[model samples]
Target chain A: MTVQDVYLLSPEISLVGLALLVMAMDLFVKRKAVLFLMAVVGLALPVALSVMLWMDVQAEPGGRLVGVYGALTVDKFALFFKFLVLGSAALLLAASLDYAKRLTRLQGEFVGLILLSATGMTLLAAATELISIYVSLELTALPLIAMCAFLGSSRSGEAGLKFLILSGLSSALLLYGMTLVYGFTGSTYLTEIGEAMKNPLDPSVPFGGLVILVGVVLMVAGFGFKISSVPFQMWVPDVYQGAPTPVVAFLSVASKAAGFAVLLRVFYVAFPSLEMDWALLFAVLAAISMTFGNLVAMVQTNVKRLLGYSSIAHAGYLMVGLAAVASRIPNGGETSALGSLLFYLGAYTVTNLAAFFAIIGIANKIGGHKIDDFAGMAKRSPLLAAGLTVALVSLIGIPPTGLFIGKIFLFSAAVESDLAWLAVVGVVNSVVSAYYYLKVARLMYMAEPASDEETPASSISLRLALIVSALAVVAVGVAPRILTWATDAAASPLLP
Target chain B: MDLEKFLILSAVLFCIGIYGVLARRNAITVFMSLELMFTAVTLAAVAMSRYVASRQVLANPGDASEAVLQTLLTGQVFALFIIVVAAAEIALGLGIVIAFYRSRETVDISQANLMSR
Candidate 1:
């Protein structure tokens, strides 16, 4: 309501307005260039503004400005994720250009939804109260469902429907949990709930504390569905394979990253007192997700489905960091574990983007995404193959790759938290995951050129995307200290 | 009913909603199940607000006049948000279902499998 609050939330406000503006402009403009330009500008402006705010914040920390009854809080944590979300939108928009022209209809609306969803993600991260988080979460989810069917094709339509129904179910489950928490605590504000739970009403009858614990589990299950955690991850492969490549890329990175941002805030900020109750459940979920995803991925022939399972496995690895940080048998605190989660998310984002960039380039060229179809990828285009090599190596957590560094930090955190069993499970899963990721690499490198006619060459934009993402992966892998420091700084005072 | 009983009833309603959602194949039935879940949440919120009001009344015996206002406002707010979310969900959900029906001539979820590789 105040000027300070307006300043704090201007990035999100502008993003929403820009989304509407882009949608309106679509009605007037016929040129694809215009739509792309508008989207780029929309995403770029917010990212730049947020980055400037981040820098200014580092120079002189800003006061936490609450908007509308402590519903949303704009602080360092919010700004960090706002930058990341908007930056992701920019990258996704840039990556969408050629693919959108070829595959999808309603190009303008697709771009608009990207911006809108990023805005929603920003708010979801900033939200301090339960209702605001729920609203923002829906805002993020709605557009994502729409985007999955941007092609307006039957297959895409089915994917969209699947995502819509599954997402709605998850939202309802999460809301029910939130309602239970609110009922027990007499307030929807996380701070209030924490204060209320500082002294639990009763240890018996599954009273206030137990009800809240069940609520938290439901919330995790809901988010687990979004992040494609095992048992709740049935929709991922079908949706990813059915959707267009660019949309799949966007969903894999942006949606997953946003999910983590919210998860970190909820577990670290809102539910720190209840860490013990959630840790064991997450550890089990993590183990299942890693093992299940890797095993499923090994059998997948479709590139998108392979990546889908790989993403689920990646979620499991991230959950290892979550469980470690939230572990109750903690000797000291698990700030290092919290830092590892951030580090892994960053590494995963870059490596996954690189992999997708390569896949998109290949898909764009050959008009197919099956593993066997990539038999002569190295002979056809050495550059694209090289990019895939980097991405695949990183994905398999090979030495001198971003994922390798990420796994090291995560495992170290687990060791520090006395989660030796969980760490061992993660390592075993990582080793099993290598086989599937290597299969793609082997097909590209060792398989003979197919007898069929040559596929088309990679597009210039896609090639550029491949190069950019590959370099980023390698750069992060080589000089991980910069990312390490940032993650550590971001994760200060672990239990928010 | 007492606060505990009302809360238990809301929880039962929630479980019924879950069962319906899982067991039903019709899109409309699934939609109704979702609505049932929302209704359960509303009931829980209202009951909790009422309980808080009663506690406030007991704490400040002379200030029972504002208790009704507090409970009603909180419960109504919770209901209002839930309604908004439900409205948004229905708009999108039905849009997809109707669009699919136009193409496929069916509303059964089991028949909605066009995304297989």
Candidate 2:
């Protein structure tokens, strides 16, 4: 609204500008590749702006900058996600270049939509007000629903329809919850809600405790769909299987990360007074999600659907960290639990991106997403096969992989918070997940090729994306100090 | 007349909407159901705002009335946002339904199960 507010929102503004520029350039540019390249290069502006904001936060005494009348905050936490979302956008654009050729007409719109969604995601991370958070969430999801339908194929249309209906349903539930919270607190500001919730009982409202509890439960259900956790995870496999591979990759990583971002902010900032109640809720959800996702994933034949289930399982793992943070709040252990969650999100981003990039490369050549299609991939394209293998290993929590360190931190946090039973369930689920993840690896390495034709080589951009993400997985796995330190810094914003 | 009566009406509409969403086969019908849910939410928000405003006016008559009115507007503002967002959601939903019908020749969600195992 003011000059200073605009200054604080430079990164989001630049991202929107970049999205529009990509759309406009599509009209004049002869080659669609140029538009793709323009979008990719323009992502640097937001990344640079985020870095500047990061430095600004570091220099500030409290390491937080509230702007737009407390609707948005620029801190290490939001900056971390800005970098992650921007990085993922750049990588996805690079990986989608060859795939965009298949779309023929909507290549420019595809890139434009991705950037627009990234803009929503960055804003979602920074939004501190309830209304701002809800708007940013819709902004993030609407483009994605459109993109899911961009393929115009029957399956794509189905994916799009399902995504729209389910997303709308969740939004309605979320809005009802927000309205109830506002009714109870008489304010829409998260800080004010927190203040009001300290002693939620009031003589004016009968059954005040039960009303707030219902509101909180409904809100969690809405977020549960976003993160693709159990009971609300029915759409994940269907959407992932039917949507374009690149969109699935982006959705699996960036969408889930943004979901968690807002989840952390809303729960920690607005409803900490109800920590014990929600902690038990998340613990139960986490146990169910991990068990259900891993068990069902073992039966999936399609690689994308399998990964979809695996993502649900991963969401459950992250919820373990959430439960830990809640239970440990009184002991001042929330910081470590939250830091572990952030670190896990970062590690999962790179690892999952690596896996999807490998899938994109192979599916581009073979034109199938079946596990049978991946047979003998190791012989055809050693680099892609190895990249996927490493990623799957990381997903299984094997040593020298990023997710291994992530799981360690998360489980330790759970145990430290006296949720060792949840930690045990998480460990058992990891073991169960390895059955399917390793099955894919075995298919790639051990099985004979279904045909004698040599698979075509992957495009250069995809190759670069795979190598970068794969190397990042290993680098972060071996040297987790840098990421942990950054996550620790990001987690500080949540501390009172 | 009373806040509880309005809230009960809103809750009934919301339950009916949920039933329609879960049981309807047609995508368009399901979308209508979603809109019904949003409308219910909007009703609840407005009723709550009015209820809070009446309480404020009774508790403090004159000097604090302006501040109470401003606070009451929060719920109304939230309802406005829900309306706008619901409009956008329905527009997008209809578009996706049309697109689905074009390819599948059906708006029945059960028939759209092409990706299920």
The whole-model lDDT of each prediction reads 0.78, 0.90
lDDT of 2 at A496: 43
lDDT of 1 by residue, A344-447 (tens): 88888878888887877777767788889888788887888899889999988887888899999998888877788999999999899889888889988899
Model 2, A311: alpha-carbon shift in Å? Answer: 0.5
Q: What does the interface RMSD come to for each candidate?
A: 2.2, 1.0
- What is candidate 2's lDDT per residue for B1-117, written digit by digit as tens? 877788778889988999999899999889999999999999989988887777767777775656566776877887898899889889988899999999989999999889959
Q: After aligning candidate 1 to the native by TM-score, how far in Å is the CA of A214 from where it should be?
A: 2.4
lDDT digits (tens) for residues A1-496 of candidate 2: 9987998999999999999988998998889989878888888888998888888899998889998877888889999999999999999999888888888889999999999999999999999887898899999999999999989999999999999989988988888888788777777778878888887477768447776777877888888888999889999999999999999999999999999999998887888877456677789999999999999999999999999999999999999999998887765758889999999999999999999999999898789898878998888888999999999999999999999999999999999888999999999999999999999899889998777686567788889999999999999999999698899999997644
Off by over 4 Å in 1: A59-65, A202-208, A275-277, A328-332, A451-459, A493-496, B56-72, B115-117
Return the top candidate by lDDT: 2
